[model samples]
Target: MRDTVIYAHRGLNHAAPENTLAAFAAASRSGVTWIETDTDILADGTAVIMHDSRTDRTTNRSGSIYDLTTSDLDTIDAGSWFSGDFVGERVPTLRELVSFLGPHDLNLNLELKGNTQGRDRSIRLVETVLEELRRLRPGTRVLISSFSPLLLAEVHRRTDAYELAWLVDKGTIGEDWRSVMELCGATALHPSTAVVSNRCVVEEIRRAGFGVNVWTVNSVQEANKLVNWGCTGIITDIADQMVEAGRRR
Candidate 1:
């Protein structure tokens, strides 16, 4: 049996609020080694851990993440929406996340959220994230990923310290994925489950020498299939379940 790595999507988001320390803790307790989360820049240049550009869905506040500062986030409850047990969870900064995971043996797959503010803002976000990583230099392995080719390219240009991955949805994946990956200096491809349904597609990508890591997978059967197809990583919300399934296989 292949040893496919299981990455807890948003830190075992199914068990706790997505992107919260609680979820990450839960994942750690479940024996997960890889965590996949999103990071975005705030108004005051702080890089925060979140999956959306807006705080409406995940927090008590309703505003763009770009318009909010660290102080503003202090008043926001990032966990209440998911469950009362996590009521006081605040949105964590990238630095905080790095510190939090420092003692653990977990690897991070940090997805850079696309900025709608413009190219300059995007560059700032990239630089801010890279700077944070450089400053802390956490013990855990880090892989920076983004759906934006421009963002990935910028990351590639600024630093070669961390690995880069290009994210693509099913319909957006084109025949030129290889060329784009090369241009962005990405060492891996994170594609949606839909894109990897065709076995040959997974084989082709692995043949090209880029690691294949599929995202948001929840089904054990599906994960088994992907692993059999030579997928290097499985990003899933149900980490404990997936880990057990892998053991059984």
Candidate 2:
């Protein structure tokens, strides 16, 4: 069997705050080669690494990410919510993340958080992210994923340099998955674990020559099952445990 890739979902997030440089650094130090994180554009048009459209959950300050500029993000503490150890952690911009991971042999799976406002904003978000990625070192592997079909289509329209993956949950992934994938020109499908529980689904997608990557998989037993069914990658919160388990297998 081919070895399945393990991506530290939001960087060894269980050990450090999700989406912070400290979390990413922890993942890197633990021998994880791939890191999966979210990105959204700020009010100032700067692309920042954050999972939510709002900053209430991950930061000390409460506000919509759309309402906050880069300067506003400076005072917000992104890591303290998770633990006292990361009290001063700031949200890393996409530019900052790329530069930080530039020296390491790490791959990035950047999930574009959709703009709730409209398509124009979503397109702009994609544009801003692409511009930031241009600074990545040559030979760095990157995958752009989104739950928004419009965003994926925009990425396909703009450039074919990076691999694109369509992120879908059980409800969003319809029976016409193949058609949807073709429409977005996605090389892979990132489905939630709930959707991939039916093993035949994984078999079907892999047989069609497209990669399958699952999200939020924290259990080793579940991870093994997916890998055995030809999963291309497993995005997990427990990177250290998963890596050791993969080694034992």
Which candidate has the top score in TM-score? 2
What is the C-alpha lDDT profile of model 1 across 170-245, one tens digit per residue? 8888999999999999999999998888889999999999999998788888888888888999999898899887
Model 1 residue 53 CA deviation in Å:
0.8
Clashing pairs in 2: none
C-alpha positional error of residue 137 in candidate 2 after TM-score superposition, expressed in Å: 0.7
Model 2 residue-pair collision total: 0
Candidate 1 local distance difference test against the native: 0.89
Could you tell me which residue pairs clash in candidate 1?
A: none
Q: Please, what's the RMSD in Å of model 2?
A: 1.2
The per-prediction tally of clashing pairs is: 0, 0
